[model samples]
Target: MISRPYDEIKLLIENYLKKEFSTKSDLIWSKPPSVELGDISFPLFNIAKELKIKPEELSEKIIAEISFPDIVEKVNLQGGFLNLTFNRSIFVTQVLQTILEQTKYGQNSSLSSERIIVEHTSSNPTGPLHIGNFRGSVLGDVLGRLFSFLGAAVNVRYYVNDLGRQIAPLVIGYFLLKEAKYKIEEKGDLWLGKVYASMYTFLEIQQLKQKLSMLGWKIKDSSVSLYRLDDTDLKTVPEFLNSLPKENEEKDNTHKWFMKLTRIQSSLIERIPEVYEKLNKLTSSKIENLESTTNQYVKNYQEGKDKLIVEKFREVTKIALDGHVETLNLFAIFHDDFDWESDVAWSGEVQTMLAELEDKKYLRHDEKARLLKNDIIAEELGYKTKYSISYEIPDTIIINSEGITLYPCRDIVYHLHKLEKFNASQCYNVIAKMQQLPQLSVRLALYGLNRTDTADRIHHFDYEYVSLIGRKMAGREFDYVTPDELFVLAQEEIKTIIEERNYSEEEQQNIANKIAASSIKYHILKMDPQKSVAFDVKKAVDPNENSGSFLQYSYARALSILSRSSKHDINVQKILESTEKENLIIEKQAEWELVKLMEELPSILIKAAKSLRPDSVANFSYSLASSFHKFYDACPVLKAETPELIKSRVRIVFSISKCLESLFEVMGIEALEKM
Candidate 1:
């Protein structure tokens, strides 16, 4: 009747091995492949080789000599492995009582003394957050929750890039539209997205025309008439060019790719033609050239050469962030702190870093930029071998010849500032895998600066990209669904499923919001972080499928079972403490399987938290739900033959609901009592 049977069993085995071998061994424990084999197992292959004995001989000798405790029902030998089966009646009772007794069953003080910083979803404040950004946000939020649950003080921060290159066009467009008659009807981020796309496409179109002209081509008017300069007469390009395949199919067709830019320009105009036309017309007449103006804006803002422009940049960035916050709120994701890149720049940290690198002789000046001699630094520091990294560490540009500090350089300064400010021991940057080299460069730069301890704690929690199946999304093109739109679609799908349930409109809305958020969160977090996800909305919302909705519904059903049982007959403490072993029956395979899965919640939490993977927890939740469903179908609860058996089953259901509720809390899924 040990409360934590798993820990007790592990300790028992380790002690036996240490005493028997007269030495400590690194023992690894695992579950047997089938329930009939055993509850837990340990392999003896390595230990056998060390002792110069056959693996099977070692396993048999160890099992024969080991003292079997009351909790150990049976011990068996299979090949080089030793497996132990727990007494089912005792196991079920102890697991249930332990869960019911502990308030925070899966939480511990393992990381109580550590402070962690998680910065994610720091999408440029130039537009609405896309689904890809949302994935990072969800991952970061879950990590924060997990760390806090493990007793670490977690700071969930967002790194806002107010002074980025993307912000220049946004600032220009915002200022242009500020005095115009055009109205901003949608959210600020969405409107700003349009502003960015229109300006970017406009600049690209003009730049393309200029390049084409240099290559013996001429374009006239906004309709984009193309004529080759080598031809004797001016002529419109053949219509077949428009029917040509996209860049993916024909990468060599440079001219055709140039023609595709005009179509994007057309799409931009079609969405917001009036404002686009006004900006294009003004820039065309040289009243204000978009490219030159934006470049000047970026240069001035970066150098603090123009106070007015800096203020405007901050103002526009704030507007875009406000819109982002609004959208994130709908998904229950919020950032605890917003660290601005401009603030880091203005604090002179970037310059200080560069000066230090120069002092250390790690800085190199090329014709175009100031480079960090990472190749040289890596060799001197033995960086690649020390870190076990496989990629080539290339020399990185820290500052351009024009004296603008690059992002990776600024990023290093930012990391140092945050760690010092927050007194954090660990930092997890939830960035995409595409930026792997840049992230590694940041780490290598930290090592070059002799911040090895700090660098060791910095983790790039990289995840693969997420795209909706059958749709291609380019954030710069503004041809993608925003998080806000995705939420709307999810809610609509949930609504269509539950509209006929006869609930009040408000309740229906509440249920829809919870289920929809859970669906999206579960769908994203269920997949491994390194695996690319092709999201499907229908699959996400389907209750019959293994989804968040299914987990919630299973929890609700379990709660319903507990509610229907007579209060007198559902007392977990009395059943576990006072009931006879014969009466507390758990003979069915399904019942024992459910107990085994429920007992694993604490280990699962620890594993997921340590690995920085919410997907493991998501998979566990689904399995728990599936196991509960199987048990529900096979085992009788309220109508059992005896009150003691009914009470035992009731405790199992109660414990599962508690386990799931805690999981939902960690995953940030809303736990609805009613499905």
Candidate 2:
């Protein structure tokens, strides 16, 4: 909502400063911390650097000659920072008028109703949705909700890698059951999940047993269910070691154990497909009405080059599968024996993919460090300043033209083909870190894409690794904190503690869902993006203070207060209060600091969306909530007798609630009604 007015002021200030300094320099303007200080703060560093004069001296000269619009009340320089103060009466009136007048207060038209495809939570449809995958799901959903609230034309999608080999073992496991043919009852993702965890221990023993058997060694079959080797087995050890066949002093060892482990691993792997197939059947298909023709792997180029690559990729994939491992990495095993050159679809695409990579300059000529022709995609078309370099590195798996097996490049090629076909505004399949990004002194040097001065279109939409709750929970342990589960837990906890809050089933369910979701999202994203987190449960669910629940409580309470207030037209800026509230902002700084936070909403959103980190929104919500609570505590509203003061109080409530609503909604926290 403040974007249009804010933009106009920014331009005026920059132009004024440019002329005043008689030197064109990048001007920096920021939101002031306190509304009393003004709606905007302009740092004096750039001007100070140019003028060679102290900021205060520079400010007097600039303010005297600047000739700002009437809304600009005063400008001052303190601590080498030039601060601009706006007319409080005008500020409060206009902002309040906008908030009251609009049906959706604090809403902005910045999104321009663009068709945004928000893809998140593309976790393999293998098992019950785990907490680790919940980060992407919730973040993506919240972002979609925020975009919808902002008036963007949005479609939310959950990509399914239904075809990948991750499903194969599950598929295999399901068939192992005698009832599998008739019922297809137990899902493989569920069945193999436990099996997969146990496989490591299972394989460790089996692999060693096979190595002992290879030495023309006979084992006492009665002593053990499998091979039971003794000291005589040591006699069969290779001649170099036979003289001194020593056992490792270590209790558990990593040696000839792998041969037997490989045998068990292979046996279990043969059962994966049956297991995977059942899990796939369990999910209710939202894909039914999907009119998407893009489900099949597609590539451009009626050019014969692609088909050739596809075939070779399949050839290598065959070799990978035949190693008794069945599937290597991603491809599922073929149930029936097939030639390496099979032309069936979904059968050999990756090997064919690799066959082409052998032709590319970067793929074939690399050293032992695994050469990749990576594309580091920014969200938009423009290149970021080098320091902002990030990664969503995609690996490609390509098959060679000769049909020779090359193991390393498959991850890279698969990534490339998928990314190219999808063509998100800025989806880069960065082959590796070394080959991507702009070095220096090059602004518009990126390949093909435009590099204009404004924010690049695609770069703003590049994929970022979603922040997770507590090291982004993975494995089976993450089940405890999923938003889905936490949502219910928090609801029960909230219901018991805040008995005054009442709502119907639908309403309570919605609130509970929001509380649970917000807690998970905020807790996970609270840490800096670059840092790893091992989230503490006590910290996340804390209800007393500074926790997400505390913020939600404050928000719900503010809503409750206003919901009960009279619905008369109250003037927001009728009076400048004296006493505790008056000196609070100017003297105490904290109050003033809180007031300035109001102006930061738009910028915070812009920056957060631009950075592809929703944590920015989460952090702002907590801070805004804290500020509202402070203001609420210091000022008495319903008890005040003066009509004007009462009106002012009512107006403050309106603004605070509006801010709270907007912040919470953006983070996908359903703004609560009563608490």
Name the top TM-score candidate: 1
Global lDDT scores for all candidate models = 0.78, 0.46
- Tens digits of per-residue lDDT for model 2 on 1-675? 343345566787677767656756677777666655566677777777787877777777777777777656777776766777766555554455455555655466667545455644444433444444444454555566566566666555433333332333333322333233445343333433533223222222333444344532343431132322224333343331333335633213323343334443444435454432332232112112111111111121111245743443333233223322211101111111121212212345544543443343334332333333433323243333343656453433232343322332322223233323334333211111122232111112222112232123222122333334444343322123434344455567655555555567676666655665566566655544434345555555544532566567777777666656644443333432222222111222333445556656766776676566666677887788888788677765666556645655566567667777777667655566554
Compose the digit string of candidate 1's lDDT tens values, residues 1-675.
Answer: 234788777777678778877644577788999977899898877777777888888777767877776778988888888888998887877787778677867777788999999989999887888888788988888888888888999998999888787789778777877866567788899888878887777666556555544544445532422211212211233333334445534324545555566567666667677766776664455434566777889888887768899889988999889998887777787788999888877787787788888899998988769888877777788786787766657888878887777888878888776787679999999999998878877877887888878887889999999888777777666777676776777788778878878888999899988888888788788889899988765576554563888898888889778766655455544554554545246858888899989999988998998887878889999999999999899988877777666877877887888889889888888888786
Worst 10-residue lDDT window, candidate 1: 225-234
What's the CA error at residue 335 for candidate 1, in Å? 1.6
Error of 1 at 603 (Å): 0.9
RMSD of 2: 11.4
- The TM-score that candidate 1 achieves is 0.91
RMSD of 1: 4.2
Q: Model 1: residues >4 Å from true position, as ranges? A: 1-3, 23-25, 213-257, 270-287, 541-543, 566-583
Q: Which regions of candidate 2 deviate over 4 angstroms?
A: 1-9, 20-22, 30-40, 51-57, 102-118, 143-156, 163-166, 178-192, 195-355, 361-424, 427-485, 499-513, 567-595
lDDT of candidate 1 at residue 313, scale 0 to 100: 94
